[model samples]
Target: MGPKVIAFFLPRPPNYPMPFVDVGDDILLDILALCDVYTVIAVSAIDKRLHALTQTKQLWLSLIQDSTFRHVLELRPPNNLELQLHSTRELVDLIKRAVIGPPPWWPGGPSSSRTPSYTIAFNTGLEIIHDYRLLPGARYMALRGASAVGKDLVMYEVWTGRCVWGIAKRTLTRFAIDVVPGGTTARVLLALPTAYVGGGYHLYVEEVDFITGTSSEVFRLGFATRLKSLIAIVGEFLLYSLPSSDAEEKQVLVNWRKSTYVVLNYGTETNSSAILIPGYIVASHPDTSPPYQQLFTVTELDAFAPHWQPLTTISLSGQLFPSTIPITTQERLEYKGRPLGEFMRTHVRLSITPSAVYRGASTVMVYVNEFPKPRPTPTLTAQMGAFFRGRRQPEESARAALLTYWLKPPGQACGLRLVSAQLATPSFNTSPLTPPRAVLEHSGSSFTVSYYQ
Candidate 1:
């Protein structure tokens, strides 16, 4: 037979159809290395072996380099495959980098960087919104706010999940918090009798008195009233003292100030002044600074009763202290005296502007949002590909049937699908054999990914 005829009739490679000579294994591996994750993910989805192969550093690095899937690896974080990567030392080193910075949470602990805890705020106004069934007995709920909220009313709601309190105070109240009757000014407290669960949490409130115009007397409600929500201790309020319509001139205070607060300890007590709560610290009113500057308050309000893992929610609000003042720098220093840092352990000076919106009786608006920005993703470098291939020249035949079946014809480009194949059977290019395929079982240190025909 002539050379052309001899080549045409010679049994074509085992995995190839008659029209094409086999392509090279090097090209096959290169194609896979070049494939973006969308394609790899789909291809891997087609076969178990392919799926395992997708986890390889080279393949992974390939997918990451593809602009489309890079964020998935970085954003989703620490995949299970990473555990199997056998690069535990590298992982540990990355976690170690986190320990050096002040964490997103308070009073720093070791190694919290890798697995940061979230600090989501629980809001007031009617009603506990969720059941939060995922929480265990050990994790507790904390109600954080400035005083005069019918915290007691809120406590009632916290315990019963019932809407029993009334709304007498508007959105703004002053004095920092409510105190026990005549006990003290600004002394907000929740006297719950239940055995505490999961250690406990703190509660702040607004306090007002009937002394009148002495400090802040212009604002006075004729009737004594109180508002509440969270179905219980989780809502807001308005407390008013009533004046006899036909008889007497009632005495009252114009400006209200913070007196006391309620909080608890888990090994140690967390300082619950305006500072510790991230939003409050940044948004405090100017005149309301100093008292907060000092040892804010010494109260441990643990409400966990033993064995009581009750399905609960609480509502809260402040007394809408009659005074109004703009948030100011001098006021910040008044409460945070000296440098803000030195007194942090002693005072709640860290304040941020509140981002939530509420219609209020006070002239000013409060905003409570301060969400953290999402972290940026890391990109895979081409050098990583070279490092990956170094491990495996790595293997046997590229003629496996499914790979052969799904293999394309050259127009396919960068996308979720495989780019086309050069009809030349993959194994043929590098092989000296009349047909193509590597006889060896393993490749190199990188391991093999053989799929059944």
Candidate 2:
């Protein structure tokens, strides 16, 4: 007898619309795989069957592999492919959160008034004379100050407020401090300014051993014979703003690890700041015939004008130190001259001027301080004497606001996104009101930590 063949087709009712639920899981997954993360999330919420199919590990892993995806999931990827499947839901949740802003309890939201996970009061005898720097994970804080005798550097656990290590008062004065981000090891860079004329600053790099409660100086270098202010440390480069001479402003980059330096002159004197973006230090040359020649980005800020200028890339293989490239146009924000106080009165605003800026892997965070204009209060005027009457006094409290932006391409304006705005009460004992310092965390969140009288 001849071999018999059987054919099976999915059942369909006449004059009835095709039921999406009847679709096969494999077919559904294939379709969902082509959708972007946001689309996938939206479709998954439509029905239980589609949601289950979208939750498969294969779908999320494929989405992550797509080069077009800009957002990232905060969770770690598993080593085992099967185990990775289990993280599909977590990856989806993180992606959703990133697309939407932070949760209410996160630092950027209004509900952040909830007490911090940890708090520490300054010791009875220790007074913080200088600002402090927090490590990447917020696990440790590095504080530098001048005591009764001399300057000291102290490292403390953020949660427990225990002193992990201390470099007591020494003859050397600490100019500035920076903490390098790492997991197991803690490294700090201390700048010691020179007091002698024509003498440059000293750079001290130290590694702290928490177990032994001791710190060892690993590297030291005399940065220059000429006095310069250490502005910032980005990656392995130390940025120094040169003293203005003959009304000309300039900057220099010292790669202390590699023992090389570069001088960049702005031609005209303008208040400026510079920051180096890690990993992007090297890039392909645009005009090279080989199409693979490398270059580096040098981002400089025109502080007076409040604009960012990304100068042309310098050849990494070039011999000229601090190679000067063609001057690029400026990327200016619209809220340049607008005062933040205008927005603080309502306790809410869409966009405001940024007083300080910090860059992350793919975003830029800006800080704003707004002191509210005072208004006459009926009760206070009647209670006080005639000397205090008839005068409108400014509010003693100010608002500390943080705004975030997605780092746009060169020559593009950064779109501002409001994050957190909080009211801060000034300390009566302090002569001048000091704005709270904002710190950005690796987990895409930020917080303002301040000390009052």
Worst 10 residues of 2 by lDDT: 348-357
Give the candidate number with the greatest TM-score: 2
lDDT of 1 at 166: 23
Q: What is the C-alpha RMSD of each candidate to the true structure, in Å?
A: 33.3, 14.9
* Residue-wise C-alpha lDDT for candidate 2, range 144-231, written one tens digit per residue: 6624223377766665567777776443454444444333356566665566655655676676776577778766674433435665
Candidate 1 yields a Cα-based lDDT of 0.25
Alpha-carbon error at 25 in model 2, in Å? 17
Q: Give the Å error, residue 349, model 2.
A: 19
List candidate 2 segments past 4 Å from native. 1-112, 115-117, 122-124, 146-151, 169-182, 195-198, 209-214, 280-323, 326-360, 365-453
Tens-digit lDDT track of model 1 for 1-453: 666643445665798654312545344446776654345556668666556555555544443333222211111123455545544345334323322223333223344323323232224432332112110110112222312345422211111122222223222222222222112122232222123453222222333231220122222222222212111111122121222232221111111122222111111112222322111111222122443332211110111112112112211122122032111112222111232211222212221111111111001111111112334443466447757778422332222111011111212222012212222333332322111111112222111111110
